[model samples]
Target: MNRTLLIIAMFCSASTFAQSPVINNAEIDGSGAQYQGNLGVNQAAGDLQQQANARAIAVGHGASATTQIRQRLRTVVDPRIDARSSIQGDSFSHGNGVLGVNQSAGASNQQANAVRISIGTQPQSIDDSVLRQQNVTLIINSDPTDSEPGYRQIATSDQAFTGSRGVIQLNQSAGVGNRTANTLSVRVTD
Candidate 1:
């Protein structure tokens, strides 16, 4: 009797897994408007609001090179203008929200010296009212480079002009090194 019950349960689980689930009241909508060339919001905030209601998920199991990638990318354009003109954006947000990336890895390796680079930026504008109550945040994490790499380098720069409500803010940082042997080498290549 126990063996019979186990077989019955296996059949039930297999049947349930084979069926596709349904979504109630499912639909998709999109619209656009254009005015003077530069002044229009080709993609409206309300449209993005609708899409953001859905949960987003990405999963990579095993070797990513051997697996499939599913993605959604937005391309916006004015229908009244030339057919070839359009703006494709990989990132967009309104008001404010958080963004993040998390990476974890297990390793067993040996290597020679290597060179690589990663770059990014975020530019924002807020009303004086909102700006007064908040401060912008910037973060950079170099992980293996931040810790293990002996030759560390960092640079920061700023420039601003005066005129108006009598307020100004500035911040700066820089790092430099001179030529050395084993630990940290700073060579001049000209």
Candidate 2:
């Protein structure tokens, strides 16, 4: 009798596991918008909210060289992210976010040294993910060469001007053999 009951229970459990996956209702909601299914969204705060995000994530080993590399981590330079937003929204505001900048004036003085870094090895069974909320900007900049030079600077004069809106300026200067990390974080404001 016990053997027969075990067989019946096994069959019942098997039937339950054979069903297909299902989602009764798929939905997403944000300020001034609703999505029944995944499509798109509009940031209401702007007449046209222009947003950009640049994120790079690597997991597992690099399957190119000899034995697979379990994991490698790295960061470079006086990394700096900056932006100032106060203008009203336009009818339609758009953005063109680029991953590469090739020039001599803007991002010309950037040097990256041996950026070999190792954080940790992932567990046998594990997962990783990252999520970013609204108006989040990350800026990494500064000297990649951490070597201080014995060069002398000629006496320079400072200029002064009158401002009405109350100027807010961030002036950062890093000498040789220096590491700088700058993060401008602003919370939600009504």
Candidate 3:
């Protein structure tokens, strides 16, 4: 039988060249988002004050039928005040990271998209490859009145993102002649 059909057409053309690539009339899309925030306040101290004072004395004596004979003494003292407060050292911290990877395959009528977001302060230095999207935010504060108190605060943040897109199309009929090949790769890791 023609040598067993030529070994079954060489095992179906070697299994289609060890197949591992397929995309037919396709569309792909992706997205990513991130945010971070932190705040802190602390105070500790001690204080107090007080005061007092007072004194008086008088005496007189005269004749004329034992008319005048008198003596007087007076004294007074009182005053003290105190106020205290302590706030266990205050502190706060925040951190964030984002890696958005959008890989789009090839085919006819194909579309792909990706995004990452953070707003405020600073987000661990940023580098955008094709700029998918990224945003980061952070804020810290401390305040006290009445002759000044005390405070300590801190905040931190970090973020990352990556995106990739690839599209390929092959259509033939009108004249009967059209063939194509394409490949796209994207990566972001930490």
Candidate 4:
């Protein structure tokens, strides 16, 4: 008796995330006694997660099993911000003021790929092979010259404050890949 068995499986997963450009302009002016608290601006874009799994099994005489899994991810982003504050004239009392700006583009990406193959047959000869491939691409533009169109300039005028001030903060980021994981397993028995 002669028997032949063949099994082939292929799995492909692709994910692409693109974030649009961000532009912000802010201006504040005070002339009299003013109290401001908890003032903030935030922007974020392009976050993705993906997973893929494949399995193949063959059981017989002269059996062959093959499995392939591929995962790809791409991200692109740009962010821009501009802020200004001015306090003119006398007796401009400002107390306990907090101001902040946060910008994030193409951040936090995760991917997982898994493959399993199993083959069983009579006692003779066994051959097994496994292959895995991963590709990633990222592009980001966060800084530009003053003459370029993507650049933003803030006012450099002097600010005058008569009272106490709290805190001022600014944060910026682009193209940050957080975590990635891949797994593969193959088994053959006779």
**Which structure among the candidates has the greatest lDDT?**
4
Residue clash pairs of candidate 4? none
lDDT of 3 at 103: 20
Question: Which stretches of model 1 miss by more than 4 angstroms?
Answer: 19-190
Score each candidate by Cα lDDT: 0.19, 0.22, 0.21, 0.41
Candidate with maximal TM-score: 4
lDDT of 1 by residue, 15-99 (tens): 7778562111111121111111111121111111101111122223311111111223232311111111111221111212211
lDDT digits (tens) for residues 1-190 of candidate 2 = 9999999999989977896532111111211111121111211110112222222323344311111111112323222311111112221122122111111111112111111112234323221212222222223444466644332121111221111121111111122222211112121211
Q: Which ten residues in a row have the lowest lDDT in candidate 4?
A: 5-14
Total backbone collisions for each predicted model:
0, 12, 5, 0
lDDT of 3 by residue, 1-190 (tens): 9988999999878978896533111111111222232111111111111101111111222111111111121212111112211111111111232211112111111112222222323223334332221212111223333333122121111211222121211111110011111212222222
> Could you give the C-alpha RMSD of every candidate to the true structure, in order shown?
24.9, 26.1, 41.3, 26.3
Least well predicted 10-residue stretch by lDDT in candidate 2: 99-108
Pairs of residues at least 3 apart in sequence or in different chains that clash in candidate 1:
none
lDDT of 4 by residue, 1-190 (tens): 1222222211121222445433233233343335476444443444443333334456666555556545566756333222222223432246465534333334333333334445656433333334344556464665655533233333322443456375433333333443343344445666
Full candidate order by lDDT, most accurate first: 4, 2, 3, 1
How does candidate 4 score on lDDT?
0.41
Clashes of 4: 0
